[model samples]
Target: MSTLIVPKLDEQPWPTLGPQIAAFIEERAIFGPGSLKGQPARLDADKKAALYRLYEVYPQGHPLQGRRRFKRGSISWRKGLAKTEFMAWVAFAELHPEGPVRCDGFDAHGRPVGRPVNDPYIPMLAVTAEQVEELAYGALSVMCAEGPDAEFFDVSLERIIRLDEYGRADGKAVPLSNNPGARDGARTTFQCFDEPHRLYLPRAKSAHETMVANLEKRVLEDPWGLYVGTAGELGQESIAEGIHEEALAIDRGEIDDPQLFHFHREAGGTYDMSQREQVIEAVREATGPVGEYGPGQFESIAKQWERPSADKAMLERLWLNRWVRSGQQAFDPNAWANNGLPGSIPDGALVTAGFDGARYRDSTAIVITEVSSGRQELWALWERPADVDEWELPLDELRESMAYLFEVMDVWRLYCDPFFLEETVAAWQGRWPKKVYEWRTNVASTVVHAVRAYREAIASGEVHWSQGDPQAADLARHIGAAGRRRTNFVDDDGQPMFMLQKIHPDRKFDAAMAGLLSWEARRDAISSGVTRSRSSKMLVF
Candidate 1:
């Protein structure tokens, strides 16, 4: 059997607390399923390293010693890696009275001894009742079934009860579903968020956001949480992906937040799925220690790969732990990343603005493109806040920003999509006359041409964006989330023209739409012989 070790970040040496937690897990917990079912839970090297890093703390005599360095930690590994089993072990340890205590100092053996927290409350959260039952409750129940730990902690179908000397429940592990009311007021010491990718749907997103916000309150308490799941789809906008992106930003020094820790292991992007050897290597790398934990794993993978109905994207996601985007992605993320320049659009440059608006749920975006160099700028985006239920875009603020842009730059044309903004468009058109034009996006043939032209421009590197601009990154995200769909209209040669559609309902594509409209306006201006010299001064309409 081949052994594959995935590379990870280098950090500080593990404190004695790491090995202590690992010891607790090994001594108390048992495997829930697979080839190792009913056996002692031994920590593999990778799992031990992860636990050590997660539990690492500042050395004694430091002001922040014993306090957790990371408030939240994520494990983004491939499927069939016993992620649930590991999480269940951590959950059991945290629920135990002696787990996650303050370290006084190192002993003669350099081991860190811990002081316990009084009455710790741990919640195992998932998006569905069945998931909560299977992943959290099922694993915990199986681990605590027949041992001395079983007598110490009574395992039930609904919850895990840590009993006192008199047999009364002292501490507990609560299994929570998606209901926000059930999760409202309980103070949680530790939380396990399982399969957060399922929470990306619009209806479930609100609950997930609320739950996370509530967990943030733990900063005043124990302030530790764990997120364990497989890699989510690229454009899914999942909470798991959001956490991973934030961790990446922190890792790159783009942002500063010491409370977040992220760990992800997957195959390289260049690995081709078509080659059998490459596929097997990637799968082995992703499914670390499967030979020991899960016998017949490679045989199962080979069988699945040979099956006629196997989905390549699904295999990439589940086995290789890669983020497989839709086949119809409008722009390759690599191309977009390569096209970013270092500066914003030049001040007072001749520019055309494209406006795409939504009333309540969807986002509104304004994209500006410099006519001389085809550099696109994400001017503004108005999105609803995660916490607010009845939020609406501030039209007055939008109008003020628009007015400022027109006052500062030499505006050549303003193309508005006029969706839920007909009156606003009319007012702007009345003010600027020739400068403001309503662009009909509902027209199939026009949109087809615009999308095709914009896609070609991106592929050809005609579009440039400011590097390190957060708004520009948001624009790229929206563009990446757009996928092509066949339109009713066809071209002259009877070839079907494609229009952009959102990969998921909650994901916004307004920026991509605005870019397309802005590109169309740029093309029109160029074709009409409208030069930058003609628009050297601010608009006087």
Candidate 2:
């Protein structure tokens, strides 16, 4: 009989560090800290059951360990697993000494491989949910091991999953919910926040507070470290942006490093319109070999996911280390330059005032208007500088101007279209005795009315401006360029109310504010209020 030859276990070829990390395992996958040998595993039946209820699967990993790890061992692969199964595996992996590895995703063909490989693979271990479970498992895993010193506790946000949940985790989350308002149960040694830039303006405060709390709690154990998200809005208070700036300062030798890990999206240059074409061309060149659609295709592949335009811009900044502008105009400045009117009003014409209040660096201007020969004439303008107190402006000048118009022109009532300006209106009333005043509470609604009035007046040939007053013409152009559209807003009843929302936050013409004020001051006539005793002494006037 021929002797059966079995290769010695020690006779196996030892792969180099690169290939060993990149080695394909047909069934069991080894990741991170490498081979799982004698790592203590604590199978918690209660925590396992709770996770089972959440994910709907058995809590314990099958055969515990060393029954060669399965090909689907990494966090991402298990995430793609049945939810309950994935949860059970994450719970088990968290408590197990080796911190989660994957067997799927081929080195070249994208085929399933059992052993971990290291060919520029995406780090799936840092997935938000997986990180949370990993955090929860850390202490337990350490406890189950011989002593605390044997296991390292990673409190990084990359390992904490609970922050992503909305509301307290009473296991009420619907499957696949992406709620940001959820409570975090991940308590570990230290924590690192991920993607803070994705947070909305409204949620910024609460999210920041949570990070601070976690940092404080962990600091008691050691000089605990907290790493916030690294890419986001340009605001001073933006969490990601703030952290990234700090990291950049460290890199530039402007600051000392506390040994913090910074994964920054470098914005190499200013994001101006001038650089837009260059960016596009760069993307094209980078993807030229693939085809016209190659740029987008390459980016999608690089990101390993489909992303929205806003997110795409952010990702490009982060990973490719590219610079990109936010790329939308607040208002079109050209619209003002092309459409503005060009001088002083003719004598003995009807007049009105356009006044706007100042709040910031933007100055407020008041324009005097008159109607003459089928045209509106701008006679004069009074402007408030940004540096001075708006309330301290010369009221006597305004009064004198109105009084002069009343004497020389067919002056209309000086309209004060807003009732909310009680102080300003009262002041004006004190200055111009017997002058007319009009007011409305809802400025937005009144704006709608004024827009309609302007449309009608223009159609009827009742609107005109001075031929030489470029500022007045520019103001007109700004007003004319203001577009209108319905937008969804929440009413008092918590129901959706469709109203006219401004298209441009930066570029809106305060036409409504101006028109309402003008209309209130300059309307033609008013009928008296109804009264039964019309001939009484008080009513006879």
> Against the hidden reference, what TM-scores do the models get?
0.70, 0.31
lDDT of 1 by residue, 469-538 (tens): 6688789877877787888878778977888887766567888898888888888878877668444483
True-structure RMSD, every candidate: 6.4, 21.3
- lDDT per residue (tens digit) for residues 143-187 in model 2: 323232222222232232221123221111011112234433323
Candidate 1 lDDT score relative to the true structure: 0.75
Model 1 TM-score, 2 decimals: 0.70
Q: Can you tell me which runs of candidate 2 are displaced by over 4 Å?
A: 1-198, 206-338, 343-350, 355-411, 418-435, 441-447, 455-512, 519-541
